[model samples]
Target: MKKESKVFGIYPVIEALKANKTLDKLYVQKDIQNPKIQSIINDAETLSITINEVPIEKLNRLTKGNHQGIVAIISPISFPPFEDTVETILATKETPLFVVLDQISDVRNFGAILRTAECTGVDAVIIQKKGGAPVSGDTVKTSAGAIFNIPICKVDHIKDAIFYLQGSGITTVAATEKSGSYLYDLDLKKPLALIMGSEGRGISKSVLSIVDKSASIPLLGTINSLNVSVACGTFLYEVIRQRNH
Candidate 1:
C-alpha cells in the first residue's frame, strides 16, 4: 500500500479539509494565537480530524518550505467503519470469519497475521485504534499487499467488538495459552471471530471474560509459547480446515 500523503500549508491544508479529504492526522504549531489558526482548529474539530499541537521546530523538521503551522496526512486506504464492515459481511449471507488483534503492538506480527488471514479467506481483521500498529508502509510490505486487499476495521475497544459480534450471532473464540481446550477440539465450522492478543501480556483480562470460547495450541516441546503471528496462523488454518471439511 502507498504511504499516506502529507499536505502542508495553512490555506492548502484547510482547503484539503474543506474538500473532504480523508486525513489520517493533523499537526499544528503549539501556542499559535492567529485567528486563521483558530478557524482551522474549529473546522478540524467539526470534521473530527485528530489534531496534535507541537513546536515550530517539529513542523520545520517535517518540511523546510512554508508550512504555515499546519499539516494534514491523508490516508491511503479508506478505513471502513466497524458497523459498515459488520453489516456488509452479514448482508453477504456467508459465514463471517473475522480476526481481532488485542493490543498487538508489533508491526511485523500484525502484517504477518494479515497475510495469513488473507490467504485463509478471512472476511475482516479488526484492531483497536489506539494500541495496535499503525497501518504504514512497513506493514503493507510485510503483509505482501494483503493489507490493501483485506478489510481492516478499527474499533475503540475490543470488548465492544466482542459484544457486537456476539449480538450479531457470531461465536467469538479467543486464542490463548491459558485455556485447556485444544484448537482441534473446538467446532470451528461456524460464523466466528477469532481474537489474538499481545505477545508478552497475552489477552487482557477484561476481554478474556467476554469470549465465548477460549482454546490453546498444544506444545510438545519445552517452550511454553509461540510467536503471536505463528499462533495466529495456526489458529486460523484450523478454522479453515474445519470449515473445508
Candidate 2:
C-alpha cells in the first residue's frame, strides 16, 4: 500500500486551505461539534474539496499525533486551474484534444485513463475536484508516471468545462452506449474533448444533454458494457485514427 501525505489537526488544515494547498480529501471526526470545524467545513465546501465524516479511529490510523478531530490528505500532484489550462492549450495546439472525466471514482481506472490520454497526445485531462478519484500514489503508480507528463485540470463541474470548451470552438463528445451514433462516424480531426463518465453510470444526463454529440463504441458481444478505462482507450484511439487519416 502507498503511504499518503497527511496534515492533521484543525489550525494546520485551516492554514493549508488558506494557502490554497491542493488537498485530496478532508476527514473530520464524526459527531464533533466546534465552530472552527464548521468554519473549516464551509471553507472546504466552497473550494469543492471532498469531506468525509470519519471516526476518530480512522483519523488515528492516518496519523499518530493529536488530530483535533480533523485530518487532510494532500494530493500527490497539483492540478492546474481549468480555465488557464484550456486557454493555454487552445493558444498552443492547432487541434487540441482533451479528456473530460465525470466522477471516475476508481483510482486505477483514473490512472489508466491518464496513461491513455498521454499516449494518445491528449492536450489535457479534466476532472471534477470532489467526486472523482484523488491524484494519489496509487494513481501515479497505475499511470506509470504518465500523470507527471500530462496536464490535469480540476474543475468545479463537468458541465462548466464542457460549456467552456464549446465556447472556445472545441467540439465536446460523450462516450456512452446510450448514443445512437458510432464513434467512427464522428469528424474528430478538429479540436475536441472526449467525455468519459463513471463506472456504474455512463455519462450524466445533464452532461450528455450539453455535449456537441454523443458516440458509442460498437459492442457485438453480449457484455453490452465495457470498463471505463478500456472504453476510454477505444475512444481515444478512434480520435487518433480520425486525425491521422
Which residue pairs in candidate 2 have backbone atoms (N, alpha carbon, C) closer than 3 angstroms, thus clashing?
A: none
lDDT of 2 by residue, 73-138 (tens): 888777788899899988899999999999999999999999999999998999987777878888
Off by over 4 Å in 2: 1-4, 18-20, 55-66
- lDDT (C-alpha) at residue 153 in model 1: 82
lDDT of 1 by residue, 67-181 (tens): 9888777766767899889999999957889999998888899889999999999999998766566566667788999988999887778999999999999999999999999
Q: What would the TM-scores of all predictions be?
A: 0.80, 0.90
Error of 1 at 201 (Å): 2.3
Candidate 1 weakest lDDT stretch, 10 residues:
129-138
Highest TM-score against the true fold, candidate: 2
